[model samples]
Target chain A: MIPVCFILIILHAYVNKIAIYDSFVSGAKEGIITVFKIFPTLLGLMLSVAILRESGALNFISKIFLPLAKIIGYPCEAIPLTFMRLVSSSASTSLILDIFKNHGPDSFIGRFVSIMMSCTETIFYTISVYFMSVKITKIRYTLAGALISNFFGIISSLIITKIFFHY
Target chain B: MLSYLWVSMILFGILFSAFSGNLSGITSAVINSSRESVEICLTMLGVLSVWAGMMKIAENSGLIKSLTKKIMPFLKFLFPKLDKESQSIKYIATNIIANMLGLNWAATPAGLKAMQELQKINIDKKIASREMCMFMILNMSSLQIISINIIAFRSQYKSQNPSETIGPGLIATSISTLSAIIFTKVFEKIYFKDGDQK
Candidate 1:
């Protein structure tokens, strides 16, 4: 898919008589600047997240939420995923694969994780990177809206999986 | 908001490690995580630059303009305040299209570019504009039509029908994107009433 996209883009650029090499170089420079701007923000966010994870704090919190998740009809196995999804994308993805391994990809829990992963974004990671890139520290209702939408997205994932997969 | 969240994570992590007798874990983590962050950034550097370069070609070739024209109505509905021909709209359209195509690594540069463009017209440099908030919200509520990675993982794990999740996944994301739109619109109406009165 990626290779195809590159070829198509180059083809279009060639057809349009664009200076592909110079354009790419300039754009790559902008990309580097962006990475430099967000590097500190990403480092800080990752440090805190790493500390939380390595300290077993994330596990403790997941345990605390496990029962509430069950009572609310969320799959118990997805407790860690629900929390990690907000903080980190890679972690939640690994959690999903774990579910698939343990419960089989065709199982209800596996299906739930797959659907949930598709619908939800890495909320904190994305919010920080995008806002920090623009130096917008005074965030307003963006957090609330993101959390609310994500909450509903998860709920809808639950409903869809249950109705379709008979979980 | 981020400050508080950052502080809480640090405090809770330290205290919890103390209670859990995992002080050494946090020690290694604190020392190592920053390095890990750098590693991740370096890895992203290549992918981001490639995508940004491609996006530049797309922009210079008038592809983005054509695509923006195609999605103008939808973009206008989401960001009503922005001029129809604004450059930010073009970036936003590119970002949304990249996201829908499941090109996440490609999406970030475009999204950041969109944010930068939006910031140009922003009144308060420190505070987020309504359009910025809306764009962020849209991003958070996933828009991918095909979760290729998830399907590949399922297939790797030998699911009977690896692609079967596509239907439910699409439905779930649509519902989420819909809710994101509704919530963003409501928040815009309440807080940004009468042209940035707040």
Candidate 2:
């Protein structure tokens, strides 16, 4: 951490090229334009997300994982970890935070789900964005691999937590 | 190192910009407004450095090596075309572990290196080779057994115990990982099977 701080400070001091700033401001302006270019998609994504949440798509989905949780001797809250994988981590973090607040952070559900969210990626979003950027239409195996990892994370979290802390 | 430097440089530029301009200005107008600028470089550098350093530590701990060895047989069955001694394979294992631990810091370098190595074996520059595509696929849907970032975030938010999510993390990520590999195998069978038929 100290080295990181020093390097950042020294770099800021020595590399303060005014011209670079000008160039940066100019580039930032253009980057902003490009962002606008993607605004509709971004907006659409946000709206879809809003719809998903408000319309109870999330609640409906979480229920789907409930049976799996019971069968595996894990808490049902693991569903959010599974659910959020398709969306953004920021959103998932918010969910995890909410869970922690309501259920006490130390509760099995809160901690396990929180850790699971941290460990995984936003698979659906990544696949959609990357493929869209590359103009690829295939919806192939991207989510599959992510799902495999999600399973490992969920089950392992349960086992690990039970053996170590919770149980 | 160079790229990390660039990202960091970019980050500082953005931060200082906060002081100079109206915070309410159109964000997009600014992106275009700042032409040929290199602000992103610094931010990227800082991010890359932290992650790379973490990755180096993971490697040094021998955890990566052992995990690779433990999973080698299974990985081999999944990616049969890859040589057992392939550096790309080793790198792929590292990347997966990084992904599992939610260590994007360790994962990205190994990912980039894996790509570079995969590129060497690829025939066409335009299209990703099969292995490259597969690696990308696995990475895209990576499972997490120990979401370190989530734990850190929780800890930051003052969760009395931050890393309390390990149990659930393992279960959720395992499902995703299993499904990913299984589907990849099916995809391989279909794609490669057709190739053989041709």
Count of clashes, each model: 0, 92
For each candidate, give its TM-score against the true structure: 0.97, 0.54
Worst 10 residues of 2 chain A by lDDT: A17-26
**Model 2: per-residue Cα lDDT over A39-71, one tens digit each:** 343343433443344434456657877887688
lDDT of 1 by residue, A35-145 (tens): 888899999999998898898887788888887787878888888888899998877888888999999999888888889889989989998999888888888988998
lDDT of 1 by residue, B1-198 (tens): 878888999999999999978899998998888888998899889888878888999999988899899989899899988898888999999999999999998899999989999999998999999999999999999989999999999999999999989999999999999999999898888887678633
lDDT of 1 at B17: 94
Point to the candidate with the largest lDDT: 1
Q: Model 1 reproduces what portion of true contacts?
A: 0.84
Q: What is the lDDT of residue A90 in candidate 1?
A: 70
Scored against the native two-chain complex, candidate 2 gets a DockQ of 0.12
Winner by DockQ: 1
Considering only the true interface residues, what is the Cα RMSD of candidate 2 after superposition? Answer: 13.0
DockQ of each: 0.82, 0.12
